[model samples]
Target: MPNTASALELDAYLRLSRASLGEWLAAIRKISGCRDMACRLHNGGGPVGALSALESEQGFIVCIYASQGMDLTGCRTSDPVVLVPLGGEPQIARQGGRWQPLGKLIVARPEDRFHLRLPELGRVMIMRPRTDILNNLVNSNAGLPIAECHELIDCYLRRSLFFRDHNHARQMTSELFCRLGRIAREESKSGCDCSGLDRRLLRAVDKIRHEPDWDFNLTELASYAGVSERNLYYLMKRDAGITPYRLYQRNRLTRVRYRLVDCQCMVPHISRYAADEGFSHLGRFAALYREHFGELPSETAQWRRNLLEAESGHSEEPLAAP
Candidate 1:
């Protein structure tokens, strides 16, 4: 069995504190493919910076940079970049537009040129999607409606940053791509407003997603959202397409799926793993799991084992008797 059993572990391709600004810049440039990228640190001459990069299985590279501040320029790349701010005031703009503060997220297309300026202690994530993913999006005419889907993107980013699961990250990136493609094909439009109940709903949803195993109720959730129980329930139904209780159940189910896929042991542990996620009723849990994931927990475990074997260059076929 794999030693790392938990799915909430932080796994990254590269995570370290750069000893010098030059080293930090080099690390950023190396991952971002921005050859001429330059940065002038605002926090005096000597400061160590934090940097981390995680590459999804689909080749999406997400790099996080943090320091006191910096004025960055000279990154003229044709790739589409998704900039998400983690903390402090970080701003970026294209050539023809004024600097725009990082509100929720920013999606820069290929034709745009990014000029970034961070004047305080700021942390931001820069994402570069796989080339084939971009090509497929363009070919399918989805044209990256990710900006309109900021809520979903925000949720994805929150989950990714909080849990730091590569498998979950990869699954989410592909799902986001498919969702954007679907959104582009739709003629009608509907979305969540960032103000009022919708925003509160998102907060409650985030809490549930972050701590899915917690026994949360309507009163507690309403208090968390700073709204009345009626409003919270109404908003959760309208914005998230599910009631709060169902949302919690779904998140718990999703976690079970991740654990099943990540664990390398055999299928008999499915019931135990399901029980670990607070599902005491084994048969009902199995039914819900199958309905949610389109496969049984046992099947998922078997699939994971097969995948690992394939990746390790092992075979199921037996050798001839000698």
Candidate 2:
């Protein structure tokens, strides 16, 4: 066994520049489709934070920020996010400007708006899940969003810190979501029967991610998930709001986009890469890529290349304590 306390530090600083912190914050906001946030640090030294991420799209991002007294105004999310309290009581005001203490785990549904003021010298870990995934949890646990969110995460984090590696993180994350969806059935009044259905749905979803290149039909997916087509339809409709096929397509497209942005020059041609990922129709692939990433795949590749080039010469400086 080895200690990896320092393996996941993507960026570190003693006193971070507003612009530097903004770069990291903006990336998260952009990917999560969150806009309209104004952040100000509590202390004069400025916001200091560290970020760690996985290569695949399946993993959760872990960030630690020490900027309490940091007041954020006009914030909202286009995804479902869990705001975990790290150190002390955090002040969060949502819907209205009224501030209050953040409970155990604050679950913010997609499109939910909130204003937040971090406690003095407080730290927090935030996990943002896709809106569709959150919708499933919300549909099953409508009356207990926050509590359900907490327990779902508790099941996943019980093992160990997920800073191992990308492939490990991706596999673990896949199971994590499956287990999360599995919870829906257990919490339902139907109990085991519905829980079994939930498990089937997740199994189908996992099959999609595991074999994105496969042109999986609903019937095939249902078979793989160990459920009837009718029940599969019911589960997706009742929980995820999308068909099994839709999630498969999204998994393929999002993974392609992630590779375009992450792998860079290793993937020489965008069309070839897209086709390899099962997007056979270039015209349709370009359109879907634009719709999902807010730009063409080429643009994403170029932007990511620029970031990698910039980082080739970049140096990290540990932030000094105030």
Q: Among these predicted structures, which one has the highest lDDT?
A: 1
Specify the highest-TM-score model's number: 1
| Count of backbone collisions in candidate 1 | 0
Candidate 2, 114: how far from true, in Å? 1.0
Q: Candidate 2: lDDT of 254?
A: 58
Residue 191 lDDT in candidate 1: 48
| TM-scores, each model vs. reference | 0.48, 0.47
Tens digits of per-residue lDDT, candidate 2, 1-322, equal 1111122222210111122345435543443335677667666544333333332244353444443357666667656666776555677887775888876766666455876676654555566654455555566644434555555555444322212222444565565555555555354321221223366777776687567557868788888888899998888767555667666665676556545543436344888878877888899998876654345676656554443444354524321111
Q: Scored by CA lDDT, what does every candidate get?
A: 0.59, 0.53
Each prediction's RMSD to truth: 11.4, 13.5
TM-score of model number 2 = 0.47
Superposition error at 50 for model 2 (Å) = 2.3
**What stretches of model 2 exceed 4 Å from their correct place?**
1-21, 54-64, 145-164, 187-322
